[model samples]
Target: MLGIKVELIDKIGMHSSDTAMIFLEDVKVPASHIIGEEGMGFTYQMLQFQEERLWAGAAAVVPFYKIIRDTAEYCGQRKAFGQPVLSNQSVYFRLAELATEVELLRSLLHKATAQYCMGHNVTKMASMVKLKAGRLAREIPDACLQYWGGMGFTSDVLVSRFYRDFRILSIGGGADEVMLSIIAKEMNILPSKKK
Candidate 1:
C-alpha cells in the first residue's frame, strides 16, 4: 500500500459506487505477490472480465424486477383523467413488454451461470447477457420514468435514481458496443487479422 494514493472521481450517476483514481508513486511489489506469470497480467485481467460481465448482468436482475414491480404499483395508484394510469392500454402493454424482457434476460443470465459453473466456456452467452442487460437496464427505467412524469424527473424518486445509476450498465464493464464486438468475435464472424 506504500505510495499509492486513491481519490474519488466525482461524476454524474452511480455516485455511491465511487469510481476511484489511483496514483502509484514509486510503488514496488515483492516477487512473492506476483499473480501467475510475470508477463501475464493482461491475460489474467482479460480472463477476469468474463466474471465481471456476468456479475454486471446478474446484478441488474433483481433490481430490474423491483423497479418493474414498483413502477407497476405506482402506475396503479397514480391516476390520469379519473382512472389509474396503468389502466391505459399503452401503459399496461409497455409494462408487460418490459417485464417480459426482464424475464428473458434472467433466463439468459441463468443459462450462462449454469454453463460457467459447469466449467464450460460461456463467453458468447455471457456477452449476450451483458449486452441485453445493459440495453434493458436503460430502456426499462426510462419507460417507467415516463409513467411517473414530473415526479420521475426529481432526484428523490427511485425511478430517477435508477435512470442515473443504470446508465453505467451500458457504459461500464466493457460497454454495449464492446460486448457486441466480443460476441461477434466469439461467433467466428470477425475478419482475420493480417500479420
Candidate 2:
C-alpha cells in the first residue's frame, strides 16, 4: 500500500454504512497519479461536483417516492376510528402534495441531466435540484412517518431509518444554504464584491 490510513467515523444515521476519515500524513503521491493539469485540481473538482450533486439529487427521488407509496398503502390498510386512515382528506391530500413535489423534482433532474449531456452548464439547475431534493427528502419522510404513528418512531421501521438518514441530504453535498447562494450568484442577485 502507498501508506494510506483510513479510520471510520461513527455516524448517527448512516450506521449501516461506513464514513471514513482518511489520513495521508507525509504520503507522497507520484506525478503519474495526478489528474488533469497540476494547478487545475480545484477546477476539476468543481466540474466533477456538478455531476456528483446531480447524482445525489437523482438518487434521492426513488426512495422518497417509495416511502410515500408505502405509507399510502399502510394508511389504506390501517384502520383509524373505524375507517381506513387513507380515507381522511388530510391524509390523502398531503400524500398527493408530496407526490407532486417528487414529480417536480424528478422532472427538474431529468432536464438538468439532458442539458448536462448536451454539453451545457447545469450548475444552477443542478443546485436547484439538489436543494429541492434535500428539502423533500426531509419533508416527505417526516410527513409519511406521522401516518405510521408510534411505529414510525421505532428503529425497526424503514421509514424511521429513512427519517434519520434523509437528514444528511441537506447537510451533505453543498448544503441547502450553499445551493441557494450558488443559485443567487447565477441569477445575478448576489451583491457585487466590494473592492
The model with the greatest lDDT is: 2
Taking all chains together, each candidate's TM-score versus the true structure is 0.92, 0.92
lDDT of 2 by residue, 1-195 (tens): 466888899887988789998988788879999877889988888888789889988889999889999999999999989999999999999999999999999999999999999999999999999899889988988999999998899998789998999889888879999999999999999888899
RMSD of 1: 1.7
State the C-alpha lDDT per candidate.
0.90, 0.91
Question: Once superposed on the true structure, which residue ranges of model 2 sit more than 4 Å away at CA?
Answer: 1-3
**lDDT of each residue in 79-178, candidate 1, tens digit only:** 9999999999999899899989999999999999999999999999989988998999899899999999899999888888888889988878788989
Q: Could you tell me which 10 consecutive residues in candidate 1 have the lowest summed lDDT?
A: 10-19
| Backbone Cα, N, C clashes tallied per candidate | 0, 0
